[model samples]
Target chain A: MTDQTTNWPDHLTGDAQPLEVGILLYEGHTALDLVGPYTTFALAGMKVHLVAETLDPVVSDDGGMTIAPTTTFDDCPERLDILFVPGGGMVYKPMLDPATIAWLADRGATASYITAVCNGPLVLAAAGLLDGYRVATHWASRDQLARLGVEVSTERVCIDRNRFSGGGVTAGIDFGLTVVAHTLGEKAARFAQLVMEYDPEPPFNAGSPESAGPEIVALRTRFMAEPDTALRNAVSHVLEQRAATSSHPVSDENADPAAGIVND
Target chain B: MTDQTTNWPDHLTGDAQPLEVGILLYEGHTALDLVGPYTTFALAGMKVHLVAETLDPVVSDDGGMTIAPTTTFDDCPERLDILFVPGGGMVYKPMLDPATIAWLADRGATASYITAVCNGPLVLAAAGLLDGYRVATHWASRDQLARLGVEVSTERVCIDRNRFSGGGVTAGIDFGLTVVAHTLGEKAARFAQLVMEYDPEPPFNAGSPESAGPEIVALRTRFMAEPDTALRNAVSHVLEQRAATSSHPVSDENADPAAGIVND
Candidate 1:
């Protein structure tokens, strides 16, 4: 992978080529996952393109918001400084889509940085991008990621080699800043932070399951039951694909065993 | 002035009316200001409507993204659980627009909660909504907000009566979580926080002037020179209008005499 540091000169007082960032947009992806990093990178003067299969507006998981993609998969820039994927309820659909997976595989091969937030890393894992790389993903999907043979980091933002992954949705902002710091320098990242006022103060100390306590965690788990089923099914499909491709037959050790039962 | 707590029954285990939130969308508004809270509130099950003057796509200040409005100002629901406004480079344009100000005045008068992020409070103040109310706004716009006779709070999120204001762009998420806690209760807000992974970890601690040190602050100040002039002109225009309508002339003491001059 090309070192982006060479592209951004030390004395970037005025002259510097705009960083080309391609953010994957798909149906039912969480809006915040895309917008958080989009806002951060845009503030840092990066050229961000919301890329999808088509130019149509992509409806978010909430079904209340629609974001139009700036470029189609076929039209996206050949070389991108950053290639990012976001995760949401319908993430399983994209994980199973051959076209989307192929796009990721092709882009991941040459992009200076490969990144994902939330369940987005699952899509990358399904695409075989995280076959051996350690990554971070939404806490709810850590077990699923480990099942895919990817080492899951507990950090909010994890950077392993050229791959940057963030935990869940809002961590995209943190991931974006880290990327900026690496590519554009800490000063540039801090300038973007100051512009966006990225100092966060949560009114409650319940952003994580550990802090949210048992009752709230149980409630959240209950609320996510439907999505969890979809995710499990998707995981099974990926595992079956891996088994079919390899000479070795499907073994219990290769699967979660508990969640290996394919629905349908 | 109606209490929203009454609308949400105490035993909201399964049954609860969706919170109707209308986020004002305007040309040249900062995308993060609206997106941060929109993501938080949407995750919390709020029916967030991107309300704007038209159904056309509203381009953000950076011109890198465009957000299509879900509903026009005239077509928005008459009653809303929360009414929000975001701020950016052309924030002054909306602050001076009669139609936008009229819509804000009308909706703000009856909305359960009135909110703004960044310099958005300047618009609220322009509509006379923040008159005699303590509020929070972007640090760069503090002097501009105080010039409007609104008491500026140094807190990241300030709630005065029914008016909830947030400091700068990223403060919207904190403001949204606070609103969720107040309306749907703490558990619901915490659930939303967990889902979004709202635990923020910025790589740099230079989010505010006090934190960024004087050198970065000076750089930011220099960067904001043009927008500052536009804001001052807008403030002067609002002050002139106030004087023309009231028997009392525009008092030098009421203005931030330092920035009361309209350059053009």
Candidate 2:
């Protein structure tokens, strides 16, 4: 058994083979979106790999903080127990990257649970994995996400079948706990929750657009205007390309990476 | 102004100077503890420098994730607006490192605010910076912090003069928002709050000892018992060393780094 699973109960350890989680890392990805869920999974004694396109460091949305990716696309596991994507101010880069979208579509097909937090659902949407699923995204991106032809939920932790997603940046914690509970039982989730001291106390009542009032929401909207527009444009372009190339849809049986690449 | 602050109002830019924040990075530190506050600070238009002993990538408590430090101790700004630390499962390493303590002591003496989240205050207490100050820490480490002669508050975000601290791993978000609210105005904090969607909905009520009840708390306590014991021993040793070396105390007036190092 790995050192990470030594203290956990037998049930949690899965007979000494811990749960393998792959969290996608990309430039401009929000740190909290990744770290929130990563901490919970780590505490749950799961093996997590920060998967990126390259082995080089991945710079987050917040310019200065850079995270070294544990595994690259060429080396990540074929099937992750849980595949997660984190949202960012500029998720369009990854949403439009063919390599990232292909990797997600490939691994996500067999993953036990396909998940995302914040605007991360947008990335999954870009990969066509969350096409008909009800996914949650950052409040600012809900409209843009809806443009991608997916059902958008306003809930914090929206679990629609196997596609579990969360709202906004800080929502990843709530989303992580919910996923843990679903996969590892409520006891384990509650245990991880206490470990993280997941009780939140927001200093202000400006979390949502309704609560933040008009002025603050407008300010944030203005700040997000460019990125929101970029995401919309990227969604439009990806949809057009998907339409152009997918005139003859391939059967799901023959759509695996081992067979042939089928985006839709 | 830098790209990070372009969206912010003129008042926050500080005449084109952003808030210079130095967050100490050490091995075994919790990823969420650092990332939570980092997201907030980044959104607040602050210049955050992840300072470490060296420029090497610092591995977090979660073994797989590694973050590259932005600056080294020698290269860090002499005076920072905020000198912060984040707690971890093995903070005893940094707590006992003389260079870390000395560096914190030197920079902390002049920083406008010396802040920490979770057991991070324990590091400050070890550096002789929190002596006689009221602080907050992870619920599990409150007693250990108090043993170092600092008053411990059970509040999530505890502010005592320039020493601001938070409770546990997830409290860093609250701590960051509180720090931003204190340094900047409520407007900036609220703005950042809305931007990040600070609204939290914990899927589980088991966040604190009280809310988690005795059973889950016991599980967490048992898990933390070993590290808790180590922290106690480290605190005892640091206190003894402080007593032994400070028999003849030099005045703080003459204790600047330019003259000689005076810890305590």
Report the number of clashing residue pairs per model. Answer: 0, 0
Q: DockQ for model 1?
A: 0.66
Candidate 2 achieves a global lDDT of 0.83
DockQ score of each predicted structure, in the order shown: 0.66, 0.63
Per-residue lDDT, model 2, residue B86, is: 97
All candidates' lDDT scores? 0.83, 0.83
Q: Please provide TM-scores, in order, for all candidate models, with all chains considered together.
A: 0.92, 0.90
Fnat per candidate, as a fraction, reads: 0.75, 0.83
| Regions of candidate 2 where Cα sits further than 4 Å from its true position | A1-8, A11-15, A248-264, B1-8, B11-15, B248-264
Give lDDT: candidate 2, residue B159.
86
lDDT, model 1, position B221: 76
Local accuracy of candidate 2 as per-residue lDDT tens digits, B1-264: 124324345543355568899999999999999999988888877889999999999998757789999999999999899999999988998999999999999999899899999999989988889877878788888777766767778888888888899999999999999988887667778888888888998888999888889988887777678877888778777767776788854232212212211111
lDDT of 1 at B224: 72
